[model samples]
Target: MTQQKVALVTGGNRGIGKEIVKKLIEKDNAVIFTYRSNAKEAEDLIAEFESTGIRIKALKLDVSKIEEFESFSESINLILNEWQVTGIDSLVNNAGIGFFVPFEEATAAQFDEMLNVHFKGPFFLTQKLLSSINDNASIVNISSTATRVALPGFSVYAAMKSAMETISLYQSKELGARKIRSNSILPGPVATDFSGGAVRDIEDINSRIAQQHALGRVGLPKDIASAVAFLCSEDSAWIDGQAIEVSGGYM
Candidate 1:
């Protein structure tokens, strides 16, 4: 019997994270996902996937808090044991909060917040979880198109994602010894409840974003989720240290 894959997804209760969890489950991966504080939404996600015969575990995690990652690592180990897996086969660093402050107007605290969540958090969390991540496992960092295109309010946010992109290259180079692969997915504007859901709820902003896509439509959670599924599968095994932009051909 082929061993089933296990994935650890951060911020898996809503938006792109939720869709990633759903798709991974459908792909037969047992998922141990994280949500910051939404116990109700987390519960709903687990309930939604019940009876799939794929185990689902949700833990409260604030990716900004690097102090808790050691304990988080312990929790992951216990969950992996419960799932009868020695280590997770994939790690999707998908937890994030949006910051819309412009560079000159942004406060030091705001910049720090972006760093803690978007860059520092994932860096340290993965370091702590390295021992529990199996050899040949894939690491998917959720980046943004902001890294490529300059948007007015996303200076600090995009800078942090650029930092993550640099880290992905190093992760691929160093972890290659263990056959582990690291990559980043840069998605263009997507309609989700992130950043107050302007792209999802406000028609003006939604249409504006949709028009930017070469496909003539804004992205949905499932769109990015599908890319993640591909990256986590054997089809992407030969692909590593790459930043794949899944933006519906947005320019």
Candidate 2:
């Protein structure tokens, strides 16, 4: 029998991250996810999934602090040892934050927060965990369609995502020798808490997105999760160094 794969997904306590964890677990992977806070939600999810006999563990982690990555890597090493697994089969950088401040009002702190979470955190975390990533493994970075849509009031967020996409390409090239593939998924306006309910709960805003998208609706967490699962699985073995947009043809 084929061994069950192991995966680590950052910020998997809620939203799209939670859905991605569900999908990965459905694929029979031993999922180790991280959450910054909300220990209750994490604990509840772990308990709920463990009942099904699927291996799921949630660790506390703040992606913004690059200094914490080494410790996180060590914890992952311990998990792998306990599971008798050599290395993790997949890593998903899905933790992120968003704001809708106009460019003129966007503060340095806001920009830095987005940069730290979306770009710097992923870079350092991936570097620290390089050794624990298995040969022929997949790394999926969560980007945004805001980078492509030229959306106002999202310049800083989009720019950081764009940087991540570039980093994904370089990661793929460098890790190719080890047979590890890196790619980015650019999701459009999804009906999630990304904008603090401005889009998810606001009917008019959601309608605007639906009108713009060719699929005639804003994306759902499941949509992005499925795309992420595809990228992590062996089905995408030949795909690497590319940003697959899950925008539903949103221009």
Candidate 3:
């Protein structure tokens, strides 16, 4: 029998991260997911999949907390030992925060938060986990459509995501010697609990965002999750160093 592919996903307890975990698991992959603070939700997610006969593990991780990555790497090593696997086959950098503040009002604190979580977090986490990832493994960085188009108040958030996109390119180039593939996925307005759930719960915000997409609707978590799954799988073997916009043709 073919061995199950294992993936490490950050912020997997909720939002897009949660859905990505679900999608990967449904595709018969073993996943080690991370949750920052909501231990209850993480526990609930593990319990929710208990009947499936697969052991799903959730680790506590704050992506912005670079200091914890060393110990976190040790924890991952323990899991790898338990699984009897050499290393993880995929790593998804999906944890993030968002705010729609204009450039003039964007605080240094907010920019630092964005930089830490969206760029520095993923950059160093991937570096620390490099040995834990098997050759030919996949790295999927979650980016934003704001980097593609100018939004009213997404200057700082988009800039960080754009930086992440640049990091993805460099990762792919540098890791190519190991046959590892790195790519970014830019998702348009998804109706998730992100940014105070304005896109999900507020009628006007949701409608306006949906109207901008060629598909006439905002994205769902599953829509982006499916793309992520594809990228993680061997099906996308030839796709590398690319930023795929999974925005339903958002203009």
Candidate 4:
């Protein structure tokens, strides 16, 4: 009998992360996801999905805190042991925050937070989880199209995301001996809560964003989620260290 494949997605409580978790479950993999807070929502999702007989687990993880990575690894180790998993098949570093502060007004704290979540968190988390990753395992880092196209008021956030893209390449190289692959997905404007306030809820801004996309609409959570699913599967085994832009052809 084949062993079940296991995947861990950070920030999997909502938005793109949630969608990714759903798709992975659909593909018949046992999924363990992390959320910083929102215990009720996390528990509700697990309860709802568990009814379908899928293996879904949720844990609280603050990715911005580097000091917690070791503990996070311990938790994962415990889960692996309980599940009898020889190694984790995939890791999705999808937890992140978006800030719209203008460059001049961006404070050190804001920049630091962005850097910690987008770049530092993934870097160290992957490091801590390296030993537990299966050979030929895939790592997917969520990034932003803002890294490629210049966006006003997103200078710091974009820079940090860009750094992750670069790190993804290096990670792929370093993990090659272990047959581990790492790649990044850069999504364009998506209808998610990342836009503070009611912008995502507002029809005007939504329409504008949709019109800006060459596909005639902004991306949905499933749009990016599908790409992530593809990368995590064997269909993309030969693809590594690449930054795939799921931006609907945004310039």
Report lDDT (CA) for all predictions.
Answer: 0.93, 0.92, 0.94, 0.90
Over the stretch 184-248, how does candidate 3's per-residue lDDT look in tens digits?
Answer: 99999998999999999999989998899999999999999999999999999999999999999
* Cα RMSD to the true fold for all candidates: 0.8, 1.0, 0.8, 1.0
TM-score per candidate, chains pooled: 0.98, 0.97, 0.98, 0.97
Q: Pick the candidate with the highest lDDT.
A: 3
Task: State the number of backbone clashes in model 4.
Answer: 0
> What 10-residue stretch in candidate 3 is worst by lDDT?
47-56
* Ten residues in sequence with the least summed lDDT for candidate 2: 44-53
Model 2 pairs whose backbones collide: none
Clashing pairs in 3: none
Worst 10-residue lDDT window for candidate 1 reads 45-54
Q: Residue 141 in model 2: shift from native, Å?
A: 0.4
